[model samples]
Target: MEAPIKAPTPGAGGCGTVWWQSGTVYQIYPRSFQDSDGDGVGDLRGITARLDYLAWLGVDAVWISPFYRSPMADFGYDVADYCAVDPLFGTLADFDALISEAHRRKLKVILDFVPNHSSIAHPWFTESRASRMSAKRDWYIWRDPGPDGGPPNNWLSNFGGPAWTRDEATGQYYYHAFLPEQPDLNWRNPEVRAAMHDALRFWLARGVDGFRVDVIWHLIKDEGFRDNPQNPDFQPHQAGINRFHQVYSCDRPEVLDIIAGMRAVLRAYGERVLIGEIYLPIERLVTYYGPGLTGADLPFNFQLIQTPWRAEAVAALVAEYEAALPEGGWPNWVLGNHDQPRIAARVGEAQARIAAMLLLTLRGTPTLYYGDEIGLGHVPVPPERAQDPWGRNEPGHGRDPERTPMQWEDAPNAGFTAGTPWLPLTGDANRRNVDELRDDSRSILTLYRRLLSLRRDHSALSVGAWRGLALPSDLAAEVFAYERIADGETLRILLNFSNQGWSVPLDEGGPWQILLSTHSGRAGDRVERQLRLEPDEGVILGPPGR
Candidate 1:
């Protein structure tokens, strides 16, 4: 195995926090980030070419989405070979260079490890399907048909149909939580667990700092294959997955044992981090931390994405998450991802700036989605150009709008490729490209860089204790404020969610200066007594010395 990267020693300076806790993690959708070749698709070299930008932007790490060998059924989520990079992405040597270059630049590399399922074309699945008595037949979840000769049970696939697919030769059904092309692995099998653990070791041996395990909660299913209870609260507007309670299909208690095993493997690798992609409510979500915080280093808190964006609501959400964390469990936050809509599209550009401040100033780790820093909203995709399977399977809900190619420059195809882009580019790509935004003093990209720089400079912002500032009943609905304290330094972040100006009282004495502002050009303003804020603005305040 490659020698583990030595951990940074903690001290009163910014190094006091562990690497994962001290800085932001930026997620890159490889296929849309940059295309080095003229094939209209991004490759590993494309990502290698962007490491300098990430380091310059001040993010400490990058969490790349899956690029494993696959048939592209679910866009790399369906892994056909766990240990090899698909030729579409490049050779294994390209992956090694990515790791070496990222580490050389002092940036941690985290890969998306998809363990719940594999492409049906994978060798293991192919061998398992040869006949009912195939030694590997038990490697996947298979059962005889239900009494009616329909699906084994009522469990629905996340892609919008029965989760089971009949095997013509074997005279049985195999379960898949997503597309039928992707078959769920039988985690209950010891051999299956051993093989998947080996896959992780393969990457760790190559010097990856960590993994963001995909569908972590779906690792183990209910052994009985029972039908899920109906969700009474379901509505016509919700996705098909919400039609049931999902008790039998996923998030089973047994999954904790499986997680414990995975955690053990990561523990063997010095200071390696494990982040689980879980979408459970805060109550159940905290359980993923396992007893004494051994399950996942970070459970991927997505409450911010699902919560209503009102000031009072967001404050309460933060409070609940803080209270729900296990005693020693670390917290993390995410605003957008390849699977979700862009923050700018959900809330207008004015508030995307505030969202950036909120994410950075929060108590725990924050993950920034690529292009979100430049205020990229959903790029409308025409029906003929739609590429996402989810959008193709379900109309009006496709993620293609949010997964468009990144706008790097004003050149053809927004400088993402020399050939036709695999996806469409945003309408504002001409004016909002990174090359243009970098030089604009008041661009959202500048705001993001400023916020990140502040985190590195202030111990309080990077690893401080957080306390929500109390607001009077009326103002509470219109304003959200919080204080972060560490290293004898105190910093306050105040956000105005409303469109009108308001005056908020300073409970404590302060001749505080504005450290940064979302509207830009407001830095270094003195504040004392009641501070007046402009409409739709957010500001960070610190003692006057700086």
Candidate 2:
């Protein structure tokens, strides 16, 4: 609960102040975090009101989802105005106040920058679509219709439908890799690149610590507008239209130049960090941190968010990511977020605590989604009640299941809104609210607090080197075991992912101390000692020779 002890250096790489090294980041879905005006939606003021809660949780930074002026087409991701806050969230002064308060609590703020596209309502797009040679027309990607009066090429949006839309006024089809209303920005243009860089400077000048670049890899498209090849294993959701491999559509080699330009702007401000959202293979993902170019400080690692719940699989992934990290590049982990289902829902309620342990103890920076520490699960929304644009298009298969509002209290609207919430509150809101579980020592929040405290107190758990241990096949499938070594201190972390009991051989030749355990049990020194782990149990053991 005490304030975090300030490290000696504020921006040095390593355990001290590497943008993301060993830091705990709390993600705030602004519209669902809290409502300041009883308007049934959260805003910047709501986040300011909850700073103490974040401080108590020991998080070092807060990654707030987009709050720019928008049409609410895709929540805040579809930016209508980049320079000011949406009236719904509050005034620009409110954002400044939020930033000041966050820093006062020693928490850094990272804004979500959606550079891939902007809402069609954006002024730049409006004028660009008004007429040919309008000076801003080239700001966005506009192409001629295909030979058969269809789309320009065989490109598909991640959300659904054609990636291009025809404009009756100009007889051109504009590109939109996501929603039809959200058109992709043409990064190939020098003027466009300069404008986006100015946008970055605008926030850095406002004292924003950094940005979480959304869809960083999708910034550049194939200049020739080539058709993507058909995917061999396309499913129903991605097939029928043009389920193709997007070799030329995204992740172009030219993205590095744009990243360098962005980095150059950040370098002007001492100690700025840029975390990119790039989903690719481990080898390709690390390349975002270019060999000689100024790459991102941390590429948001979504492996934990996408991996299955098997112990061996997770262990292998952890090792692979650590190995794949580029030199001078710090690794990061995200277990849950506004766009994905909560880890508690993905695994199970019983395993939530263990997942938290694994997350905090892992050898990298950890980002915890809002309300995740309380073991919040996704609330199933009926098709008619869904608000996600993707869900609106497909009706049932989109992410509406995970984007529900946060549960703050057991009162009406789960203390998220006094009026009707934009989304429905979950059925478990009454019991899962913060006030109900904060006092319970065994609650998931309390477990998170303890885990964070342990991480902060011990160097081995935070900035240590991880070494995977091999166990029996059956035990390996259900139990994850790894050792962390730093500053001559070694800590062994063992977690049981399943509900069944599992055992691992412990080194009995030397004294082994039980530093922490989710289950109320103890371990003593013994040669070849057997550890009987209960379901969802976790134990952190001190160094073998300590």
- Which candidate should be chosen as best, given TM-score against the real structure? 1
Off by over 4 Å in 2: 1-16, 237-242, 508-510, 520-528, 543-546
**Per-residue alpha-carbon lDDT of model 2 for 348-467, expressed as tens digits?**
888888889899987778889998888888787877777888866765456766667788788988888878787787788999888888888778887888788888777767776667
Give lDDT tens digits, candidate 1, residues 426-500: 877889888999888899998999999999999888877777888888888989988887878889889999899
Ten residues in a row with the worst lDDT in model 2?
1-10
Structure candidate 2, residue pairs in collision? 34-42, 508-526, 508-527
* Model 1: per-residue Cα lDDT at residue 57: 88
**Pick by lDDT: which candidate is best?**
1
What total of clashing residue pairs does each candidate reach?
1, 3
TM-score of 1: 0.97
What RMSD does model 1 have? 4.7
Task: Please list the C-alpha lDDT of all candidates, in the order they appear.
Answer: 0.89, 0.82
